[model samples]
Target: MIITKSREEIELMRESALVVSRTLGMLASEIKPGVTTLQLDKLAEEYIREQGAIPGFLGLYDFPNTLCMSPNAQVVHGIPNSTPLQEGDIISIDCGAIKEGFYGDHAYTFPIGEISEETSKLLKVTKESLYVGIEQLRVGNRVGDVGYAIQKYCEDHGYGVVRELVGHGLGKTMHEDPEMPNYGQRGRGKKFVEGMVVAIEPMINQGTKRIKQLKDGWTILTADNKPSAHFEHDVAIIDGKPELLSTFKYIYDALGVTSTEEDKFRSKAYD
Candidate 1:
């Protein structure tokens, strides 16, 4: 069953979401060539603790790190390691946190430095598809509506939408009801309602949609050994539309990029 959050509960979740958002913002400047994912993980842990919230991913499923640091061909759940990132590579950092009895989870894929034009376009299209998916998360829309939007947007650009993994509802628990897939048919699955919040993420690949897991049993990679991109946002239905609980403003600020893309999704109250 889908759990609808009260306005008070939604605000609590927003605080949790912002905690993870701020953690990512702090790490944004630190992501580059020669930096190890393990190092980023350590920084995230310290920052989250200082905020008075526990790392949501740590020990939740026996996962050892504070972040899921997936790089290059890796899709998600890649354990942080000593491997130093190289220029032209990209890494997706998925983070979660719990504060005031609520959970926030989201992800962002970052380029190490200068990347290939092909890879750059992949990231661009994947991120665009994320917003397209988010636009479908409005009242009266079904889960598939959101998935179809994402899939169509990416597939039109020759990208593969990951089938095995999907987004999920969020609240007191990290994962809740109504699995949000990246690809599906419209008018199918559960219909969205007001006060419902979910983490809508699109994991798109540059090659085939098939994926494989490494021996570590955590890392997922594209079957053809091609690169993939993942972008996520925490969204809630407020006043009959989708409101963003997570923001990329911090990331953009850290990276020195200026964008007003989120303006349409925010209200004066959140400002």
Candidate 2:
């Protein structure tokens, strides 16, 4: 069953989402070599609490950390550890926060320091694939449309689209109905409607799509042990189009990067 939000409730969700967006922005400048994922995780917890919101991922499924700190070949759900990131390496930080009784979840893959040309391209393409997927999350479209868009963009770049972990609807509960896969056929699965919100994430691997779980029962890594990238955005349907509830603007600003790629998806009223 789909959970539709009223205009007022959607505004509340936006507030919740911006809290997460701001948290990631604050963490952007602090990410680099010699910093452990555990350290970053700790900072995230404190910051979210300071905002009067609870860490959504903490203890939700017995997960110990506030962020899923997956690095290099790791796909998602990687537990934070003492391992210090090295230059040329990349890590995906998947974060979730609950505020005003709503949950906001999204992710971004960051380069540890200066990355290689190939790895940088992988990150670039994977992120691009994410927007491609979000563009499909409009009214008159189905879940498969979103998946197919992501898969087509990533596979065409010789990347492997992860099949196991898919995106999901968000609201009071962390994981809601309508699983949003990264690969599927058009016209398949549930049709999207206004007021419906979902997290559309694309987990693209540099090698085969196969994955495995760590002994810790949390981290998921690519089977080929090759580098992978994951990017996500929280989207909602409003006025029959996809509106972004979360933005990478803060991250971009903190890193001094410039891009107008996400402009089209952002809400005009909020602008």
- Supply every candidate's count of residue pairs whose N, Cα or C atoms clash at under 3 angstroms: 0, 0
Candidate 1 steric clashes: 0
Residue 172's lDDT in candidate 2: 92
C-alpha positional error of residue 240 in candidate 1 after TM-score superposition, expressed in Å: 1.4
Tens digit per residue, CA lDDT, model 1, 1-271: 9999999999888999999989999999999899999999999999999999999999988999999999999999999999999999999999999999899999999999999999999999999998899889889989999999999999999999999999999999989998999999999999999999999999999999999999998999999999999999999999889999998888988999988777777763332
Model number with the top lDDT: 1
Give the per-residue lDDT digits (tens) of candidate 2, residues 97-189.
999999999999999889989999999999999899988888889999999999999999999999999999999998888899999999999
Question: What TM-score does prediction 2 earn?
Answer: 0.98
Error of 1 at 140 (Å): 0.9
> Which regions of candidate 1 are displaced past 4 Å?
268-271
lDDT of 1 at 157: 95
- TM-score of every model versus the real structure: 0.98, 0.98
